[model samples]
Target: MDERRESPGQADGAGRHREGEALPAPPRPPRGEELGGGGFAAEGQYFLKYDHSSYQQFRSWAPAVLFWAAVLCSIRFPAAAAAERSGEESAPPRVRVVIAPTLSYGPLWIALEEGFFRDEGLDVELLTMRRTAEALPSLAAGEVEVLGSHILPSHMNVIARGGRVRIVADKGHHDPDGCTSEAIVAAPSVIASGRLDDPARFEGLRVATDKGMSGYFYIDTLLATLGVSAEVLRTFDLPLSSKEAGFTNGAIDFSTAAEPWLTRLVRSGTAVKWKAVEDFVPGFQSGVILYGPALLDEDQGTGTRFLAGYLRGIRRYNEGKTDRNVEIIAEATELDPELVREACWISMRDDGEIDVESLVGYQRWALREGLIDRAVAPEEFWDPSFVRGANEILRSREAR
Candidate 1:
């Protein structure tokens, strides 16, 4: 092996200098200048050298060292920041993760307030986006680091468009009933017509959807099963937040949405639950953790650290022994604590671990829904190494 020594005053990103350079001799003070030297060194000695040749040599090596130093600093910043940020503290790697504001997003809440994210070295800042679709695009565009949102369709569409994103982990899957995120609802007109008692009555009623959203696919699947065709139910593009009011105000006869909007419509009596998507598609997961591909590809170390922290969070979240976890979720999601508790019962898994079965199911749904032109393999969208590493970390802790 070639033996190379690092020069004195030469530092890496961690601020560690080499012992290769020569030390300067001690100097005598002029008179009584208050002795600036510290306790470690004698009164007149200087820690740094000020020599012409030495300075020139440093300049020669400085550019390359500085370049690599920056690279290392970028990689090390998050870990260092994570170390400094305690549960109640803030740090550089403390990412501001945004999730849709709803009861379904309770697990993220549990992770944050329970100190799971902090344990993972993340200073999580959870924000509730009224519309996840609208929010996810920003994450893809590098406006944010992580987002908790529906994994299918939008995630696929993003990948198709060449956005650097991957579904590293999953939150919850469709219940045993096969319902995923959206619940099918009929407008007051359809519900009040008493025709709701008759399945054929919905044939000609207009239904509003986000057009390309999972809700749209849920409605399509429901209609196809019932022998209803697209022509029978007029499909209109509508925003989810606006859908409830539209259905109640007689603008549309049917619509699909996620809770608490779905719950709100049912509670307010503006609409009735027609069907849950999980009724047909079982083990369908929702709310995935995504990061830009560039980060993973270019900065492998930082990317690894990020995933390690993420998995650490997952490990902490899996220890759900009581309602304390539920309360954490409630506060994070800003939903009523009672509603969160109820939602938490059906929601599975708090960690960002991927459910293989659910991912395949979702990919199948996207394929069937024509969201993607061709059948893209599930692995194309998922990177399992991170999840596996997280599992290993947890297993190691258990072993210890």
Candidate 2:
């Protein structure tokens, strides 16, 4: 049989240490240490030195015990380690979007209907206000998080007033020879006299729009291109809701308008098409995405999430034949499907990219006409980061 050796904590022939290795001595007591029992004798016997009346001795081990206990606890438990490793939470909050009832917002409806925001873990509520100007004030007041109804001049006016609104994305750009949803509507009398071809026709005509808005800018620019000073035409400031009636009642000889109103005017004999915006300013980006300084301060994640979700919807809507998407847009806009289909096929850039060049042109003309204080830098106005992020999401989904 093999012989076993004793270890430091055991008696000879019973301890766990190897037989050839020397055992370490037990730790020595401090000077003047009291002995609870007499030291071990040569025969391995122990005896108490103190009488029964005396107090029992204690070891000075509180600090050492606590140190070792902490080490042991850390080794056995893991939640503390995990707590140190994880950083702050990054979950995004809900994004409230303000939109208009214009045809340019078709993409947003498509995105909502297709559940793209849901897929991206975002909660988006879209509220359609009556006009972009109203939405701008609400956005400035923090009542809304995003605005998609902001056209160039309205945004510029806000900036001029020292508001910190910035364009973060594009809606749709105009296409050449496109069936423009925008029309410079004229009275039947103006159309009958061949004023549509006469550069001098608008010299004395009063035109109405939300003053200092892009609608006004577009019409003014068209007149300027015809060598007619904007000062020559009587410019009227009218609420968008009043535009159709204003045109029909002869309150204004002409006015600029977007869809449904244009459709209404055409159908109801209130307005005649004097000019198509696309014919004069092809590739002009109509609607834009905007956010005020408060929104930019509160969260960037919300913006990213909204864009990602929105882009996903765009891709889904454009998935196959555009006709299906057009039908969907028509329903959302409350226009005849055929009219919506015709407008969709013509008005929007086929590729869904906003025309930056056209915007640059619009700005130049606005400066020349003195609509804005000065020519705002293109970089100062538009923010494409959200658009880029949205496009990336689309590309990634396509890959999958």
Candidate 3:
């Protein structure tokens, strides 16, 4: 592997990332605070390394000695921080994860609050970004470690070219037979006009998309099946929080929404649901877990542990909208507990798999529409090794 990595993109005239130009390296922390010394960058995935001596003979027996020690001691001392305080152990790996504020971030939020990440021996810091696209640059430059966001068309330019970021796991996606996870809604006037069934009527229509177009995949895909090209419609990028206002205030005639926003708006009668993303493209991946350089290139052990923790969270989340899950999601997202419970819950894979076929199909559509600069092969952007390792770890732990 080349020691030097490439910057993914620079802003074009239209403010879109254009590949082949460089983004400046992210600002570095002061001495002693840099990432390298934290041990997370090169820590063992399954075990802590407390042995430092160069005795060649010990190499044969040390791994066994240490493995049992870890097994025995781990029960008594759950934190790697305890070992670090003895002055003989390396610091525990610390991960800074960026998550968008929504129900889609259920796994990460659950993991953070439930101590799953800590159980995996990781010190994790959670950061929330309202518009996940704004965090891509920092993520590509490794200023941030992991991200919980949707798989956007624009981000393909970065992942396909630079290799600094990766789609490691599924955050959330539309379940075709399940209650709506994402939908396209039309204003009452548009619905009343009955032009919605006429493909030609979509021309010059106004639409509101989630800011950064993360959730636009649902709208764009749903509309395309009706023979409406995205170029024919005028689109506005509004925050998820602002979609209701945009609909009621007539800022947009059609818009895309995710639950519980979908439920909230529908109950409020701001707009009527026109289509669900899954209705058009079944099992379409909407939300994803991204790995920046820290996890993608520098420390896969931590990445594996991170995914393992996240999978544990997924299992907990898959337990349905139990009172515990409802409370955690409500507190984390600040949605009303009643609304959270009333809303159609989102679904994700228990094993952290991304829907590659759906992803590739979306990429082809994006390329055909001139919506993205490049398309990536599944292997180029999605790495399955971490998920495989994570599952193995979970199985081993369960056996014990």
Which candidate number maximizes lDDT? Answer: 3
Residue-by-residue lDDT tens digits, candidate 1, 1-400: 1111111112331112222224332222221112211111111121123345534544554565555555555655676667677544433353435555565555555545445555655444554444455555656765556666676577777776777787777656667643234567887666667875666776767778765666666676677777776667777887555776787678888777676666666777888887776776556665577766434465444444555555554545555425676665555545676654443233455345566676666567668767775544667777777666666666777799
Output the TM-score of candidate 3: 0.76
The parts of candidate 1 lying over 4 Å away from their true place are 1-94, 135-137, 177-182, 192-200, 298-323, 342-346, 350-370
Q: Mind giving the per-residue lDDT tens digits that candidate 2 earns over 56-103?
A: 332353344455445545543464456456864433255666665566
- Model 2 stretches astray by more than 4 angstroms: 1-92, 157-164, 294-297, 316-353
TM-score of each: 0.66, 0.67, 0.76
Worst 10 residues of 1 by lDDT: 1-10
lDDT per residue as tens, model 3, 1-400: 0011111011222112322234343222221112211111111111112234323323554575566445545543544556567766654576777665577777777777787887888777665544566577777977778877877876788876775888899888788877787788889888999888898888988987643365666666666677787778887777566778888888888887778778878898999988877778888887888888888778999999999999999999999899999988877777788988888878889999988998899888788767777889898888899998999999999999
Q: Would you list the clashing residue pairs of candidate 2?
A: 6-15, 7-15, 7-16, 7-17
Tell me the whole-model lDDT of each prediction, alpha carbons only: 0.56, 0.60, 0.71
TM-score, cand. 1 = 0.66
Candidate number achieving the greatest TM-score relative to the actual structure: 3
What is the clash tally of candidate 1? 8
